[model samples]
Target: MTFAELPRMGSGRVSEARRQHFHAQVQEVVVWMRQYVRRLGFAPVARSWLYALESEGKITKGDFTWASKWLADRRKEGLIPFELVGADTTRQLTGHDNFDEEATPREYINRQLRDSLEQAAMYWPSSYWKHQTNYPILWSEKKDVLKLFKPELPDAIRRFAGKGQADVNSRLAVVQECQWAQENDLQPVILYVGDHDPSGIKISDGIAGNLRQIAKVEDWECGLDEMESDGRIVRFGLNADFINNARLLWIDGLETARDEAKGTNDLANPRHPDHGKDYVQSYLLEFGPRKCESNALIANPTAARALIRDELWRWLSYAGHKQWEAENHDASKEAAAAAEGIKRMLAMFDSAGVLYNPGLIQSLAQASLPGLPA
Candidate 1:
């Protein structure tokens, strides 16, 4: 098509084609998520699983909201809740509250050695990173994912409120933590997860600025004194591409959000000041104007965990993994060495005439001193 004959969006129906393709992707994502839930054996698709349903038709924001209500309707008609967890297969451990169940001296010594060895083996990554990292890891995200996500969180990383925009204290804390990270020669990374909405896009942008602003006034006598201002926030979830890639169902209510953002349906003049037309349209283009909740990912726990892990594992390396393994070996060896030293001391004392039974000895005097033999 000639330039003059081109469709206003781009080409001879090209813009229309792209828009259609984008909508198709949205529908595909919605359907995939619905199928994903149904496959999980949520027969009649329980009330809780509505946001995940992939429905048929021209997709809109309200379809998702209706899905949830549809699930509720099913429940009202007597549909059971989806079973995400298995039945109580937890076997009860033997109770040891009684003093008679206490460990003997030999057992206690062995237990200590075993525990130290296990910790060395298991926590070498923890140890290696402790010495290796130059920055503190501070992670914050929307609260909804916390349940399926808590298990995947690292023990060492600092977790913020993990819900919504960081509150005033939370924003201030970022500055304080950034200062701490800088003082320690550590790079601070903020991994953010939130909904893919007008505000979600803005949330990542303001955290650093908010921190700097708060710090200038409340922290340093002079504003941003020697502060690196180098930290960054990674919008880890509800990104534009993942909208369909993860098959997130499109929820209704974008109009309300849009209205709130612009203070009107028309984007010509938005009342939100900082987040007016540019902010709204930019995200609309990238995300196809379809919004999703972080919780939608929870429907498929394995995939959700895998997705989150993929993002987090970006922080580590093969070299780091190997280093952790080496640290673990060293830790285990340390434990083994301690056990051997104690064993040798007992064996040496047993050989001495002053000690008949090393286990029976009440004090060091019961046997010859370490340097002095019987």
Candidate 2:
């Protein structure tokens, strides 16, 4: 519901009834968040939960600061588990090693051995994307997106262009990977996701131009211009339709990194420097001053994942890829069988105490190779 729909409060003293009503709303929000956390099976970032609440009409963009503090308060009060809130890895300290110990070292070794054997039996030597018609690289405008979609997309190589622009080193590395893909006769394609703001839209639209410039300056073997001509960069998310359909919340003002850093209103604001620029004017006319962040997509996790997979399957089918992987493993069945046989032999040697008898082992080695000196 919009702010206008909310119950108006008197500017004077808050009545006991009004206070109780506000408390009831906070409890409702907490209960809803708990359900959402359970659905996800893990604590996502606080903003993700906020977006979810926004989509549900339980809160608005302006409620972020107040809601965030409320959530933290509830968590501290033991109404919510601490694990129900995701931690920021950026500020985490390094060189920390803390873990639950197993019953014993031998038990750990046995468990590891069993895991190793299982993996060996199922291992495939071929690359996951070997037979695909196109080589796809997943790109996101923000690094935080990596947390939501990366786990589901194991085979796709990921590149994060933080704030929609790749630095020189990142550009060089991605281009090199694309070159390798091209050499293998695969069409290099970048499946991109970004915000639904002016800069985001412009960056998505300019991906091919940027890549073309990179390839030209680097003098790469593959013609990125010709390759990208067939709509190689696919911006498959955070569009107007998706935002409306998903019921995402939009921030009221147009704010950029510079505006944020300088603590000033800029970008599309009337008092700002570039408000009258064509790009700014066009964006303001089309999308207005409000902007939806790409992180808002995390609110609808299943649909967001489906959107990614739908684009991915255009180049490679999930069933086809799995079948190919199984076939590759089957082709190496002899290796697995040999490994099993070797495991059995080692077990027998250990049981017979032959492994501990160094002199016996030397004699056996000499017996196998008669030319060895006594």
Q: Considering every candidate listed, which one attains the maximal TM-score?
A: 2
Residue 329's lDDT in candidate 2: 70
Model 1 ranges off by over 4 Å: 1-49, 52-126, 130-140, 144-155, 217-231, 255-289, 299-315, 340-374
TM-score of each: 0.55, 0.78
The backbone clash count of each candidate, in order, is 10, 0
Query: Model 2 over residues 46-103: C-alpha lDDT tens digits?
Result: 7666676677676778987777776677668665567667777757768968863778
What tens digits encode model 1's per-residue C-alpha lDDT throughout 60-86? 335556545544443353332333322
Task: Compute the lDDT for candidate 2.
Answer: 0.73
Off by over 4 Å in 2: 1-35, 71-82, 96-116, 150-163, 258-263, 317-323, 329-335, 371-374
